[model samples]
Target: MEKNHEFIRYVLPKGKTFSGLTQAQATLIANHINSTARASLNGCTPFELALLLLDRKLLELCHMAWIPADQVTLKPTLLK
Candidate 1:
């Protein structure tokens, strides 16, 4: 959580204040940061990293449960 707060502060434009910021503006800033390439991701965006991790997690769960492909339908809403 501390890292996230630091990231929010770093991404906010110079001379801008977070005070009274609207939800839309806050989301725009967050999306911008998440999409920007980072050295830690070897030039991949965080969203890409998240999707890769999510896929691995889903596969792991399916294996653990011995779930048959025909018995399960992993819908897009499951990601949310």
Candidate 2:
């Protein structure tokens, strides 16, 4: 999907290859992304919405966590 591509581009370092990205780095990025509030979600973050709607066990199985809104980081420094 185009959004997925955009997210990948947003998270990846400029001029860097995604192939070099590690799983831990990806997880960190993912957590930050999910923690971000979106207009599409009426300003509620994906993590908050998931916690309200999805089963807690399922969330735990996926290793998802609620990153505090103030702590969310979507910049290149996040992966540094």
Candidate 3:
């Protein structure tokens, strides 16, 4: 809380790297949220949440970009 969390609240980052704050402040928030959320879970950190979020988003994007296939091809090997 020495740098950023000294204040009661903060705005989420608008871009990469949790911008517009001090490292100590960012660390404090990360630690608190990790501890609390982890305790509630069996010991999982927010990083796990982030990974799950990324996977879900990727799956959604893939589904959006999916295309119908005209036919299937079975290839044992490619010939030179």
Candidate 4:
């Protein structure tokens, strides 16, 4: 909810109505924002942050004693 409000206040033109946006337009706008860097993320975009988190999780799993050592070579397919 707060993210939506921030988008409206900063991204949308003055006096523009949210209802005026088409579904595709709204999604495009949202994707653009998520891909853009923000100060709150210390200059990383939300997408980058998510990928970083995923990488950390993968590392942690690979370090687990029960996990096969060969599995450490596996990488996240989507992010690449």
Residue pairs whose backbone atoms clash in candidate 2: none
| Model 2 global lDDT (CA atoms, 0 to 1) | 0.79
lDDT of the candidates, in the order given: 0.51, 0.79, 0.37, 0.50
**C-alpha displacement of 75 in model 1, angstroms?**
36
lDDT of 1 by residue, 14-62 (tens): 5657686766555545554555556777977665676667675763443
Stretches of candidate 3 off by over 4 Å are 1-17, 43-80
Residues 1-80 of candidate 3: C-alpha lDDT, one tens digit per residue: 23233222332432325455575544444434333334444665444555556675763443322112222111111010
Best-fitting candidate, measured by lDDT? 2
Candidate 2 local Cα displacement, residue 3, angstroms: 4.7
lDDT by residue (tens digit), candidate 4, 11-62: 5656757676666555545444556566788976665665666665663443
- Which portions of model 4 miss their true places by more than 4 Å? 1-4, 52-80
- Alpha carbon deviation, residue 21, candidate 1 (Å): 0.8
Q: How accurate is candidate 4 locally (lDDT)?
A: 0.50
Give model 2's TM-score versus the native structure: 0.79
Report the number of the highest-TM-score candidate: 2
lDDT score for candidate 3 against the true structure:
0.37
lDDT of 2 by residue, 1-80 (tens): 35545666676756978787787787777788888788888998888999999999998877788789899776677888
> CA RMSD for every model?
13.0, 2.0, 18.8, 13.9
Clashing pairs in 4: none
